[model samples]
Target: MEKTTSLISKKHYPILDGLRGVAAIMVVAFHIFEAHATSHLNQIINHGYLAVDFFFLLSGFVISYAYDDRWSKMTVTDFFKIRLIRLQPMVIMGMIIGAVCFYFQDSVLWPTIHEVPIWKMLVVMIIGFTLIPVSLSMDIRGWQEMHPLNGPGWSLFFEYIGNILYALFVRKFSNTALAILVFLSGCLLIHLAVTSPNGDVIGGWSLEPTQLHIGFSRLLFPFFGGLLLHRIVKLTTINNGFFWASLLTVIVLAMPRIGGSKHLWMNGLYDSLSIIIIFPLIVFLGASGEVTGKYSTKICKFLGDISYPIYITHYPLIYIYTGWAVGSKPSFQEALPFALLTLIGAILLAYTCLKLYDEPVRLWLKQKMLTYKPAFITVK
Candidate 1:
């Protein structure tokens, strides 16, 4: 297989971008359905948590493709600035959205929501905007999530760690060295996933030591594996790229929970194999295919545009929906209409933030902070 020098030189992979959007949508669905169930065993979208792994893989591949060759021209500060520009705006918006929806989310699970002062929530939201994880004592919400305002912010925190590691260390490693790192991370991931009492790799939101282990275990392998895949794989031209890639992505994400409760390792094997093997295939096919029709191209572009915004912002609403569902214990048939409405509301809210807040904030930041010209890198 021939190796390519830079993702900077290649055209944007529209299908991969769309696949991200698809995965983001699936996450929203998963969270909605998650509200209706007591545990992963009964959750409708049992495998939806794997979407975070998918996001890490996609981020790694894109980072490698875009920056692997530009490190010589780019300083570490510039790279950090670029990443912050791309990500922090959404971080801020997600937190603000969470804060705005926080009071409305009061329920039995978060009974103290009524007692926590507004200034405290604002303080939490302000800290959250910086992408800093708070300790449990400062946790305004009772959930103990590192970012109580927006639970999904934990992934972004790890993503920042990955970026720092890439800038300071990983980028310097040879392919063999990087492969060893990925291998070790994969082993850790498999062990963590299999051994967890829940029979899945889903417990990374809290601030405890064990949850920290889960967070890193989830982040390292797929992110570095993606970087490795970009370094090694030959991209073949493929047809109906978005359709097939999205279909496979949905299948993997929606796959029934493996091994059930009796055999936890069985599910762990499923998680590890999917990340190690299947995800890279999806990225390859997505990168190799083109958006053929005008309508398809538009759809992919829209999906790609909203993917990050949706993922980051939708969970606060999930907190609200979860509170409502837990209080009512509504049947799926009864909840379906409101669930559909929640999905629509989340999308509309994401689009609104994208246009009104995120886009303009990023544009202004780029003008003020991006002193060095970024080498062309397509962001999904």
Candidate 2:
């Protein structure tokens, strides 16, 4: 039999770490250039916001692939405990950091906060602090449940939801049905994002919990897309890394056409294309072992490791940095330096926090959490 490359074949792939590095940098470029055209040449960096969608698509596949089987076989308490360890500790630290920044800065997080009350603020804070996904939106004395401090934080809630749903349903249905549900979710999200006519999403202003009604609908697709892709590729043993690499290259080259004519068609095409391409490339590079090479991967893995913290904390920093640079006019000579400094600064801060909270918390949780059931436990 011909040897086939499989992400499933390996337990750890550093190239995915490298890919994480790339994806994180793409987001940094996208945000660094926010709304300001550096030059027509700068569009590549500017348009990198697509990276976040790519991250979501990738996350859907990765987190699910990593956790699904574990959840399926483990006891409920074990399942929740593993998830808590995997995600919550660092996430809560991020929330605390964000809250501190919000309190100190008194500025908006992503220009999303219009009016948030003390009670609603308490709820969002408490939910974030406790790491629960609360889309149960309500008006308590005219206050609303919203995600105020960090816009990216809400995605974690949906992530946890996806994990639970997969664990519950994966054992009961055929793969086909699961695929259909996930694909439909992606379609619904695209429809909602574009259908507004004005292009403003439902919670355009803030990362409000209410935004998640549609947002959850939107994220469902990518998460499922990733998970399904992993299962299929692993089962079929599709090993042609070149095929995926070429596809991603072409997609990146063709990105110039994104957000243009045939808007919906083009948008969906690239979005889907990215996921298909990036994940395999990730697997391939990991198998190749190039990601561990001297100098580059070292820095990249470091960046990748710290990505979550930087992502959560950078928004406040960006707002402040941009606001400060507003008067400086920030010429081309200064742009690169400023951007580099901002990115580096965010990375360092994240690294410190990761050491303080992320790693220790993950270790403790893994050691203490319940694990997947071995075959002996089930009478299969």
Candidate 3:
């Protein structure tokens, strides 16, 4: 018997990375505009919430591409450790940022924030570190968010669930079985989308039953669909894939709401079709293309690096922005400067976190946890 190591770094899809960054930036913009909108139909980036669904699809494709074949040499523990190192550091940082900014966000939007005990907020932060969602009864803020300190953590919670399902059950699924699962999940997604009262697939940050249904409905189709796609689709070369895909993504997310007050389901149908059809097409294009020049490559790299940090950490700042907007009730022109500042601030903070915290922490964790050899292993 010979000792062996199972840690091998897989090549990433750069265009996919860039697309992710594009979507993350759009989410920040969406949230910033959310402060002024009276309802979903009138929001600046009406379909920006679809970015989460796109992310789920990307995760599925990437996970399958990276790990589906590695189980032959990797233990379940190894897979989990790898995921934690990659994802958990920023999660902790996001929660901390949210906690630090919590009191500053006290306003008409979150009336109880100023009065909430510091100990209770700390408790929420600690639980947030583990990604275990708090109950509504425990909500310190008036908003019924599962992770009130950091609302984006809800998507991450579902992300963890997808990973667990993969390691424990879905990884073993044959392409046929996975296809069936994807089909069923897709149906559920479509049903939920078209029938939703708001005519969009938006509310998944809460822990209540309806939101949970929205959560799982939003999670399963795109995730497993991406997995199934990776299993089935053959690669083809596409020129300037990043530019085209990024353009298409921004267009879809920035599109105005389809239906007005009387035709809400029209918007829901649009959401379903975009998630089911358009997003995967974007992923396919992104995965197939190569970065052509030094300039484009650098742009992709920067966007990829800062995408997750911007997404996970920026919402705390949004909390402050929302507080101000609600209290002051400023016109769009009056609010423009602050909104732009918030966007710039979110990008800068995300970049700082990426350089100072996420990269170093992940590197250290990988060295400690993933770089090891088994003593009694047979080399095949």
Best lDDT among the predictions, by candidate number: 3
Against the true structure, candidate 1 reaches a TM-score of 0.96
Tens-digit lDDT track for model 3 on 1-380? 34457555566688898899999999999999998999887999888999999999999998888778878788899878878887899999999999989866667777465589888999999999999999987798768999999999999999999999999999999999999999999999999988998888998899899999999999999999989999999989999999999999999999999979899889999999999999999999998999989999999988888999999999999999998998999998899999999999999999999999998997788767874432221110
> After TM-score superposition, what is the CA distance of residue 226 in candidate 3 from its true location, in Å?
0.8
TM-score of each: 0.96, 0.71, 0.95
Ranking by lDDT: 3, 1, 2
Candidate 2, 1-380: lDDT as tens digits: 32322223325444455455556655665666762554333345533544544555566556545655653345556556656666677677766765655545533223323354555656666777765544536222121334455555655666667667766665344579877876677567666655533232323212454465655654566667666666665432334432343345334533543465335454545444444455445543333444334765475457558666666666655655655455466776777788888888777777887788777877676545534422211000
Off by over 4 Å in 1: 1-9
Q: What is the C-alpha lDDT of each candidate?
A: 0.89, 0.54, 0.90
List candidate 2 stretches off by more than 4 Å.
1-10, 35-44, 67-73, 106-124, 131-145, 193-210, 234-269, 272-300, 325-329, 332-335, 368-380
Q: For model 3, which pairs clash?
A: none
The ten-residue window of minimal lDDT in model 1 covers 1-10
How close to the true structure is residue 375 of candidate 2, measured as C-alpha lDDT? 24
